[model samples]
Target: MEIFMKVFTKKLFAGAALSIAAMSSAPSFAGENPTSPIMGIPASSLEEFGGREGVRAWVESLFYYIMLDNRIAPIFREFGNPERQIFLNTQLETMVLGGPNEYQGASMSAAHADLGITMTQFNAVVEAAYNACERNVIKYHTCNQLINALAPFTADIVTR
Candidate 1:
């Protein structure tokens, strides 16, 4: 068992070192500029995304995927409340599409802080969110803009 223990110790230390290096190399987070295309998108332009109906459809598809997909559903399940989930999803769609409605939900970090979420889970959620956007043919630049707009909230969401 001594050999096994040594291997595990080395692996653990290597992982920790790599994590620190990655953190040090990451770009500094500043707030999103209001002038960026993401924030600048007019509510009228959202018609390309099928407007309110289209946004709602995409959100439903995304949530269905999140519910059925083993990798992502559990994290959402931990938070529970189907009705509230729908509301939150609608708010996200509206916010991204430049609708007049503002998102009144808690910050992403605050909403997710108790879940002990890992980096992998966060990435999975982002991928799912992107897929939802793509399914509706929302422009890539717009999708990226939305992600950038929402990225700053990670500070509250990541518990680990």
Candidate 2:
């Protein structure tokens, strides 16, 4: 399982990196403003995951993987409550999928400021998210796109 996770993580990161690069130079779709992609994700991508309920299920799967990961589980145990899970679902829906933008949590930096998170721990969490995406049967490119959307928050999240 460990070896499999290593390989999967490598592929996921590579795919996400390439997707980000390509998107950076990609042209706008017909009748779509150049910046609209930034403002909101195409509804088609959401549909690929079976819509909003699927996103919530993905979040549930993410936490399941996170808690199973010995490397990061302890660090995240504090956030295992039902309320926190709901907040995470909404936050991810807003942040990665361009949903309603109803996230009311603190900034990522502020949220992790005192946690002293290391780069390795952060990457493990990202891996878990990718795993969740796969487990939810989201398309490869859509998963990559979601990861790309989240890439910018690394600086704010990896405090150590």
Give all TM-scores, in the order shown.
0.65, 0.70
Candidate 2, backbone clash total: 0
Model 2, span 29-125: residue lDDT tens = 3412322233225656666766567878887888889889998888778644645866666454533453444445565666678888777787787
lDDT of 1 at 104: 55
Global Cα lDDT for candidate 2:
0.63
Model 2: what TM-score?
Answer: 0.70
Give the worst 10-residue stretch by lDDT in candidate 1: 28-37
Leading candidate by lDDT:
2
Give the whole-model CA lDDT for all candidates, comma-separated. 0.57, 0.63
Ten-residue stretch with the least lDDT total in model 2: 31-40
Give me the candidate number with maximum TM-score: 2
